[model samples]
Target: MSLTSRAATSLARQTGRQLAARPAASFQQHRNAANVAGNPNESHAHVTSPFTRGASGRQDTTVIPSFKRYRAGNEQGNKVFQYFMVGAFGGLTALGAKDTVQNFLVNMSASADVLAQAKVEVDLATIPEGKNVIIKWRGKPVFIRHRTADEIKDAENTDWQKLRDPQPDSDRVQKPEWLIMLGVCTHLGCVPIGEAGDFGGWFCPCHGSHYDISGRARKGPAPLNLEIPAYDFAEDNQVVIGT
Candidate 1:
């Protein structure tokens, strides 16, 4: 054969061989690309995921969109709960304040009513001479003694300066025969028995205090005379005990 023909035939064989191998090479390349896509460690060229670098220099993937939506819903629900709690607290506080104001008003009204009706009246015509009568006036006991002539003379003749708590018998009575004073003893809050003392007037057995017919503290621990109620005679026998 000629040399040029031989060379051309050889080249054609080589081209045919290369063409026969082309499909296998193409399939091998496609398979390599699929393996690279399936591998977890390899980075994709076309697709990218959002990531952030942390302080440790590691990449952190973004949270899923569904998780972000759920978090936002939770935050909104929390805000609603907080608002409800605040509203309920405000309502309770207002109710408590209203109750306090009402209670204060009620107490003030009751106190005014009590003070307005504190005065009392007493009838003195039933009391006999030289005898003692006890009456209630303004929630305290008042002693009313209708003195006999002899008792008045005895009380007046006594020395006023020699008594422990000194007062003239004439100063204690608006009418000389009527002796009116509180029944409470000056030494303590005990009530005294009328006309039963060493002074022939009132005796407190609880502390052994003695008062005279004129209600002056004569002996024992009593520091002052018996308190006299503010009284005025409405008539010859009727008296008003308190203003």
Candidate 2:
């Protein structure tokens, strides 16, 4: 071989060895860079999309905060609704209790009135003729008289048109022998004395009123006659004053 040809061959062999060493070194460097970048403690920025899933295959990290806010709002709303329900129920109960108390009071008042107006009884055989007997009934005085024949005749013969109240004798008595009336004067609610008036019926000293035997007001300031009590004859000698 010639000197020039040997020199060219040695140069080509050195170039091929260098090229092969460069490829191996470059591959090792790329592998080391990839390992360093994949380390967990490295300060590398992770770019994940908003719609991407997490490790548990659920929604992204933002979903957790949104769910917590929704739960809080629901809890607050539930508390407010509970308070409103309690207030409405209490108001209804109070109204019902008030109505019940008012009804009880009204019923008690009516019962008391009914008990106060109980019936009164009187025996006609105990009363003497030409005399008057005063009895108490319903917190007021009632006058019962066994009228004489002469008194009845005088009462029947009186002129009813000239009297102050103008009531006939026939309307004042259930029986001709008996005359019953209330003792209170029609003028000012004053009680009258029986058989002492100018007309021989009743006299009111407070108002200077007089009544006849038929309970008709004669010379008086009274505008009405003596009132006849509601009475019924249960037997011949017995009478019920109230019905």
Candidate 3:
């Protein structure tokens, strides 16, 4: 037969079989309803329905839930188990987040060996009196000036009370001859020229900021004195900068 004719015949046979099964199901439903009416106290397990018939024409057993089923003794225990499971999951998640944050902070921090090199050691023997030496420490220029006797005398004699950023020379320096300070001008972070200002100290040509021999901001727009870094005389001629 042709493909179209075969499909039509197959569809007709399936439709006929369905129509024949419907009447049998209706009859069974009517008979079951009559049996239930006749015996009102009949057991639910032996009840028959239009649907759910096995090969031997018996209905599958169905359990009807009562209100007491929900109130079973294990309900309280199940709730507690659920709460414990949620708490355990949350704790594990928090632990993972803490570990991630700790690892991130550790990666951002400097290593132990690098921290050990934080301080810079300078030999004072290489520097001469009446001259200034600029060295890099912690990525900033440090002014290490070995003052002459006349310069020290001049710094002490200068009226610190009249200066814009008032600071005594004795308080600024650790020792009389050695004057250590940062070379950066407080006005706009410009490096000042050493031994060249009006006061024979340091001059910032960028904004005409002047510093005295004692590293005091003596003139111009510079707001504060040259910053003094942390340093100590390790030996007779050796100094260590930074904590």
Candidate 4:
């Protein structure tokens, strides 16, 4: 058979089947009506129709809601959890930004400190004779000396017992009493303590390093003498370090 002919025949068979079923359905409806009429005062129960109904037998529909129409309890909770998760992630990002800024500031401060240390400066008038004062030069501590007659004599004495390096030839201080040197200890950068008259010289308690009035390291574990900073005499009493 041709394809169009076969489709036509199948449709005809379906139509005939539906027509035959229609009569049986009508007969059953009629029988039910008759039975209902036989019983008088049967309290006519309401019946619902899909299409528009006449005033004789009309009833309201009872709607049943489908589960797919709304969210379940767990699904609602999941939405709330998603919102909280997003907020938590945002808070973490803010904290990370704060920490990054703080780290950058700390690095900048450290760089400034290094620069200050590379360039030291001082004034001569501030330091008195026979006494020493701590001055920041080139970002490091320096001892400026104002030698008295007695302290100058002590530097000249050069007694072997008092000094570890008596030669005074290979020392940081070029002069005996009127001296200037880096106050920082060469061993570990600790500033040495200088006694005006009682201790007689600079003493480092860190490693027992002793320095003369001229800031020359003489005794203890310190390997080298006190450093003489680069400086020049400004006037009669003025001095400038790291100029």
In terms of TM-score, the best-performing candidate is 3
TM-score of each: 0.54, 0.57, 0.65, 0.44
For every candidate, C-alpha RMSD to the true structure in Å: 18.5, 21.7, 9.0, 19.5
lDDT of 3 by residue, 1-243 (tens): 999999999999999999999999999999999998887647455765545545555545573434685685888898999999999999999999999999999999988867876798999999988889999887789999999999999999998898888899998888899999988899999999998888899999999988888989888999999999999999989999888
Candidate 3 similarity to native, TM-score: 0.65
Question: What is the per-residue lDDT of model 2 for residues 29-62, given as tens digits with 9 covering 90 to 100?
Answer: 9988888788733533364445446554445655
Against the true structure, whose lDDT is highest? Answer: 3
lDDT of candidate 1 over 1-243, digit per residue (tens): 999999999999999999999999999999988898797445554544445354343457654433464465477889999999999999999999999999998877747545654655667778888899887766679999999998899889999998877889888999989998989998878999998889999999999999988999988888999988788898888887776
Q: Which stretches of candidate 4 lie over 4 Å from their true place?
A: 1-123, 159-177, 196-199
lDDT string, candidate 4, 43-75, tens digits: 444633443235654443553435664766688
Pairs with backbone N, CA or C atoms under 3 Å apart (clashes), candidate 4: 119-138, 120-137, 120-138, 121-137, 129-146, 130-146
The 10-residue segment with the lowest total lDDT in model 4: 169-178
Q: lDDT per model, in order?
A: 0.84, 0.85, 0.89, 0.68
Candidate 1 minimal-lDDT segment of 10 residues: 49-58
In candidate 4, position 41 carries an lDDT of 36
Q: Considering lDDT, which of the candidate structures 1 and 4 is the better prediction for this target?
A: 1
lDDT of candidate 3? 0.89
- The better candidate by TM-score, 2 or 3, is 3
